[model samples]
Target: MGRIVLNGVRKAFGEVEVIPPLDLTIEDGEFVVFVGPSGCGKSTLLRLIAGLEDVTGGEISIDGRDATELPPAKRGLAMVFQSYALYPHMSVRKNIAFPMRMAGLPEGEQKRRIEAAAKALNLTDYLDRRPGQLSGGQRQRVAIGRAIVREPSAFLFDEPLSNLDAALRVGMRMEIGELHKSLATTMVYVTHDQVEAMTMADKIVVLRAGRIEQVGTPLELYRTPHNLFVAGFIGSPTMNLIGGAEAERHGARTIGVRPEHIASGSPDGAPWVGTVGLSEHLGSDTFLYVHGTGLAETVTVRADGEVPLRHGDRVGLTPNPDRIHRFDAEGSRL
Candidate 1:
């Protein structure tokens, strides 16, 4: 494993500039996730690191060695793609062993490495089976196994779980987390899913329009996002962002309160009042959508299992002041 550095990295296609001059330092063995909306350049940045795309300007180095001009094969990184990219005609064993064979390893070493990777990925039973014979999750594992067999200095994943069903995606997410723990290799994962980024990343890099919005731990981003974009992007059910003028006149500006931070009814020492408009019960908890008062749109609040409130129910909403996030007129945190 080795540290990866990007110094004033940039990419442009003719006159359309995609990534601006950006700087990042990825520590050796760290699991860093790059997350942003589509066309925001997260995948482009990952490709730049993998040597799949060249840097139009700036320098890239791995373990103190400059690698801007190096080809993908010489970059000492393995990339797993969303499509699995398994060979339909080759058995799982052959597919996993292909990289080793290409590298011209001894027969004994290649066989041993393939067996070890297959065992680690729980694919020993499917070694003789082709990609066509395995399930979606199994096929993804084969793709991962192929990367593992190469034993590169770092692993790059580009939405590797996007192709799987919800349950399988969760399972594969856990598998990838476990694999990182066991291997402890440098990893850079690119995804638009905030849930995946939050749950699996040791550090999260939130991007917007080819620029980095913020970089921090999951909870750090959740608890204290630097601006409105991040405040809205990092959480589920999203955050309720009231306008700065309206909020400040009421003692706060651009007030942000999470769904889980709001409670039903006019609790003692509550901050604001709104009528309930809709409610969603998810077994473990209920979400109350409130309207009316200073807020322009429906604001969501979390309730304990099965809120008795219904549509058009006249109820008061209160936000915990300590839990609220205040942002300035420009959306920067205040």
Candidate 2:
């Protein structure tokens, strides 16, 4: 019963409107991620839902009840921030018990929930230790354990993994996803990293400049973006966009081809010719930046990890015609 709906929700600061009116719905037990570049207003929207910030217009409903004006705690939601927010002086057990203690729950209830959350988060053996004694990942788990004990209807995460190193970020991402499965609670997450959004969300809301560009499953946005901004932002290595005469030839204002769709070896007659500018080998795959391509200033091609192509090597690239994405002059999908 954790469904949340926003009807014409908006946010403004003085005379400037940061979030224009928008509508969105998150179903019970669904994991949704709000993602976009910096200053895109994803965090602002999350705060609006959390009741930490009041909406300038319209309403927020939780489980069909209006909660727009409710204070953060009264809204029955929990939020995990980018910072761990754990009390350094408190032991893991006490840190997790803080929220229950504040609410004046009985000592027995607090102990029960804390133990359950600790075991669930793999912190059972570390309960006696303080936050300063744990690694970054363990400390984050303690923070999550604190949230889990509250048992809120929905959980809101504000870039929870941003503080971790790359390897730890990956681990925590999977851990959070697993937590969602085990808890089966509605979760709304915010991040600027598309990779995190793709890996963790059941539904993804892509925002830019306070507006939602698109909302759908990760594959939906990746396979069929609504417009140019979405097409360019949703993929890794990004989709290559070409304009000028080359695009005109395709009866479009611009043409887009993903790096993976551009093959290095040309067969018959390929449209792009360039010298490999830089090559990155990551064991699993190779990324080749091709320069001097008349179609675009630089055309990136994803090649096999064992690709023999090197810097300054002349190459021809062929884009899979069926996979090409066409956009109008205003960057709308054609």
Candidate 3:
């Protein structure tokens, strides 16, 4: 029952308004991700829901009750921050039990919740160790365990994996995804990393400068973006946007085609031809950066690893006509 709804929510500081009035509904048990570039106010929005920050206007509803004026402690939500924020002197067990102890739960109940959280986070053996003795990932798990014992209706994560190394981030990402499934609780996670949002979220809320650029499932946003901002931002390596003569031929102000959707071979009889400026062979896939196509940016093409193309070679590229995306002068999909 962790449904959260925001109606005309806005946030301001003095004369500047970071988040403008907006409406959003996060359904119960959905793993929703708020993702955007820096200073986009995704974290501020999350803080408003957690009651850590007050809204300048509008109402926030958690479940069925309005929580706009509630204090952070009474919001019934758990937040895991970018930093672990663990007490270096405290053991894992003590760290996890702090919340229950503050609420004056019985000794037995505190112990019960601590053990359950430890087991769930795979920290059963490390419970007696201090935060200083654990690895980065282990310490993060301890932080999550501390949050889990609160049994809040929803979990708020603010770039929880940003502190870890690449390998560790991947490991923790999968762990959090598993945690969501087992708990079946609504989770609102914030990250600037689109890869994280694409892989972990049931729904993604894309933001820019405090406003939502788009909201949909990973594939929905990938397959059919609402506008140029979304189309250019959503994909890896980005979709190639061509304008002027090429776009005019397609009866559009601009045309977009993904790298993988384009086929490359001999320059003869090809719709578009260019010289390969650079080529990257990454074992499983090969990427070619093509130049002299007359576009503002070099065209990037993803080809098979076995493709015998290299720098300085002439190549032809033909996009899958059915897969090409057309856009209007305003960057809206056509």
- C-alpha local distance difference test of each model: 0.90, 0.93, 0.93
In model 1, the Cα lDDT at residue 186 comes to 92
lDDT (C-alpha) at residue 333 in model 3: 93
Q: Rank the candidates by TM-score, best first.
A: 2, 3, 1
Clashes per model (N, Cα, C within 3 A): 2, 0, 0
Model 1, residue 96: displacement in angstroms?
0.8
Report the C-alpha lDDT of model 3 over 1-334, residue by residue, as the tens digit.
Answer: 8999999999999899999999999999999999988999999999999998999999999999999999989889999999999999999899988888898989998888888888878999999999999999999999999899999989999999999999999999999999999999999999999999999999999998889989999999998988888888888888999999989999999989999999999999998899998899999999999998786368989999999998899999988999989999999999
In angstroms, the error of model 1 at 88 is 0.4
Ten residues in a row with the worst lDDT in model 3? 291-300
Residue 80 accuracy (lDDT) in model 3:
97
Candidate 3 segments exceeding 4 Å error: none
Compared with the true structure, the alpha-carbon lDDT of candidate 1 equals: 0.90
Q: On residues 62-124, what C-alpha lDDT tens digit does candidate 2 reach at each position?
A: 999999999999888999999999899899999999999999999999999998898889999
Q: Write the per-residue lDDT of candidate 1 for residues 212-266, one digit (tens) a residue.
A: 9999999999999999999999998899888746687646568798988876775
Once model 1 is optimally superposed onto the true structure by TM-score, how far is the C-alpha of residue 8 displaced, in angstroms?
0.4
